[model samples]
Target: MKRKSNIKVIRIPIPTPTLLPHTTTNSYLIGNEEESILVDAGYDTEDTRKLLEWEINKHGLARPKRIVLTHAHQDHAPGVRMLIHWMPTILCHEKEEEQVLSAISPWEEITLIEDEDSIKVDGEEIIVMHTPGHTLGHVSLYIPSEQILIVGDNIVAEGTTWIGAPDGDMKDYLQTLQRLRNLKIEKIGPGHGKWVHQPHEHIDFVIQRRLHREQQLLTLLEKHQQITSKELTEIIYQDRIHPSVFPVAQKTIEAHLDKLLKEDLIQYDESKSSYVSPHF
Candidate 1:
């Protein structure tokens, strides 16, 4: 566990069976000694539960009375099952209710939250911002006093966060980044990996990198005339990613295609099962 800022912000990196390069999901303890909130629960495992409890005791902070979820991802929300003994009130965005419910038992208590809603921990306010893109109900917590943002999977310490279809939207993700960039954030505690100290610069890099990928898709479509998302994924990320991640890369490409198609920047050839540049 690591502490940040003048406030009692403890980052508890709980081990989980997450994706490669990220073996643990960050569960944060934010509040004063009297009352606190736990953000994200990691995966559902006895070990994860014990580690979290141990960390809280070790830090000498009160057991979190609330568990605020950023989203309903497997690695982030499943651990609530183990914490059912604690009976902490589970809170998530309204849009995420279905997913969160599906992950936990029916008897668990849940509260729906929305954008601009404030959660207080010992008089300190943590504002919830609906930052979708990673997921429809993804939220990032803002601590005005410390100028810190706790982003789930929206912004990672390493490579960019994956924005694929069904749950992910490239367009919404890009807009979320822009919105976060406008905030006066001093540091960001992401769901995985180390903390992000340079918030704006990192947000800008994520934005530009996504735009650059979109441009790459457009350029590839213009040259190839007609290309499937699978083909585009191969050409764009060939050798840079492992075969296991190809499906994810393809989905991201499809999301980009969806955005471009909506903007009339590209056209889809339904009969050919491929996308083409408008000029083509």
Candidate 2:
């Protein structure tokens, strides 16, 4: 199931409004003369479909054999239904398939992928990496031959990816970052923003930023005897984020708190209804 060695990936950028700072969601077309597949069709609008068709026609890409979703986020998976008429097999990780199909009508031809599963388009092998954090079932695809990692919200090219609480775990995010850093990636094709030319730097920067944010959060907590997640969010992130995005920022803050609490560096004071630094 590998694509031909000569077929290069074509990135079809589509405009989609999500909570993210970026304006366009990148849908990648991977294929060759024999077969092709699409990754992350985020925009389902008529205009988006037109653009996709235009790109396919412009580049002379064969109709895709399947559509692979990296995650089930609204910004990434919503467009699947629009392309369902194309009759491509919709594929996602087993852990993420349910979430991916939650909003769309069920179809009998869905394939659940797993880590190390290689999806061959033409003849190229696209390897799956189950890198959860931004979402529990989030995944990143690695094309070993091309050394390109298609990082779906796991690593945004510009603004940091928000790790939501409950479903999003900071600990898992950090682990995933580490996992990516260990890879031999040359470039990162993020779901949003520009392509990352140097993945090592991008991955390192992302991980360091998260660690630094945690440190800042810890310092903020230490400054106060006790602070609720809301209070903490107000003091640490409210000013930094727009009012409309404050809610999402709070969820990320809560995720950070969860990590600290798990590490015994912080504790939840049920009586005070606040988070307390163990040092305090």
- Top-lDDT structure, candidate number: 1
Where model 2 places Cα greater than 4 Å from the true spot, the runs are: 1-4, 106-108
Residue-level lDDT of model 2, residues 1-280, one tens digit each, is 3333667788877888876467788899887656788898876677777887788887888878698889877767778777767887888888887787784455446898888899887777889899989888888899988878998988888878889865798998999999999888779998888889989998999989889889988999889958898888898765777787788888988899898888898999999888987877
The number of clashing residue pairs in model 2 is 10
For candidate 2, what is the lDDT?
0.83
Per-residue CA lDDT of model 1 for 1-280, tens digit only, reads 2234445788888888766567888999887668889999999899889998888888878888799999988899999999887878999999898999988765369999999999988878889999999899999999988888999999888887788878898889999999999998889999888899998999899899889999999889889989899999989997788676778778878888898998999999999899987887
Worst 10 residues of 2 by lDDT: 1-10
Every candidate's CA RMSD? 2.6, 2.5
Which residue pairs collide, candidate 1?
A: none
* Model 1 misplaced stretches (Cα beyond 4 Å): 1-6
Q: Tell me model 1's lDDT, rounded to 2 decimals.
A: 0.87
Q: lDDT of model 2 at residue 221?
A: 84
> Worst ten-residue run, lDDT, model 1?
1-10
